[model samples]
Target: MKKCPNCSADVEEVFELCWNCNYSFSEQKVIEIKDYTIQEGNREVNCLRCDIPLIFSGRYDFHEGARLGAWGNLFELFVNSERFDLYMCPKCGKVEFFIPLNDSEYKKS
Candidate 1:
């Protein structure tokens, strides 16, 4: 484990980037998450590689298939179990993940 120089946050050895401050170890930079929002009615996204429209898959929860045990329950407490909407390209099978602005906003009708 190493500490992020920028944020002094404890970073795991397996992870190259710091979760707290987004500090890159190799680049020696603090990368920030982009501020973007998905339009409520808009759905289609183009695939950069295949140039095909991305199809909306579904929401994924990290804790979905987690086993119920003492350590598993303890692990869940420290982890962020945010749901992300998955999009996939039908032709190339490339996947992309996006966080919805409102979790309970709309259905895919």
Candidate 2:
């Protein structure tokens, strides 16, 4: 822990800016290592429209090919796939996504 120069509060060693005073520590090397072990697994979320628990489905990847036009290879951008949690509400006949495709469960299934 490092003491903030402006407010004298204890700031995290990895934090460059003091949380209390917002003092910028440009000279310091803040090493931020994110640990993914503690990340929570994907869980079911209720549908906003029907309040029904959503189901986890499979994942799909979408690749955008280069556009063949006058300016060749100008717009060769990659489009990310849309991961969706398939959910159906029998009460209201509503089908929607409970979670996005970037979620961990999307890759798992």
Candidate 3:
């Protein structure tokens, strides 16, 4: 593992970018980052661990037999192409799932 010169975080040898601080090893500088978190009306989302705004990663349709965990999907009836909003923390790579807040098409399971 190589230590990041900017943040002093240990990065894996094969990676060119530092995941913790967004430092580019080949360029020898920190990269500029933009916040692309899609904000919903009166509904703000943030990472619980990193406290950073979560970036919107588009909606997804989970089909039947999708393995979310050993116990299975969160909404059992969501197999019918109902979409869920996906958000992720850029720094920590933590992902979060949310039901669309402003969408009227969202159905209750």
Candidate 4:
């Protein structure tokens, strides 16, 4: 166990930041990730690159801090950081990310 420098709270050695105070042990800060997955049922989605069926993975509501990552920068996370539906291709390892339809859209579908 390790003590946090800022809060003096006990933290596990495996983790760099203090879970209680969110203190950064390193120069980089930790980003918060929130999951907002909705059941889309068994929808058939295919990968464009490999032409293989995609598997429904999970969903997430990324915060502004996490939006600073590599792929996060590509999307307009700064302006619009909405919920995303994640899909993965088992063969080519391609990830398909898109915004899930809201309640109104779901009714239309």
lDDT of 4 by residue, 1-109 (tens): 9888777889999998788877778844544634444456244679999888899887665545444567766555344345667899999899888767543343211
The residue-by-residue lDDT of candidate 2 on 1-109, one tens digit each, is: 9897777889889978877756778854343544433222245557678788765443334445555687545553433344444555556666664335345545422
| Model 1 Cα lDDT, one tens digit per residue, 25-90 | 999998876645555424667998999888888877654346467688666665555667888989
lDDT of candidate model 4 versus the reference: 0.69
lDDT of each: 0.76, 0.56, 0.78, 0.69
Identify the runs in model 2 with alpha carbons over 4 angstroms from their true place.
1-41, 66-109
Question: Against the hidden true structure, what lDDT does model 1 obtain?
Answer: 0.76
Better of 2 and 3 by TM-score: 3
Candidate 1 vs candidate 2, TM-score winner: 1
Q: Which structure among the candidates has the greatest TM-score? A: 1
Clashing pairs in 1: none
Tell me which residue pairs clash in candidate 2: 83-101
Q: Candidate 3: minimum summed lDDT over ten consecutive residues — where? A: 35-44
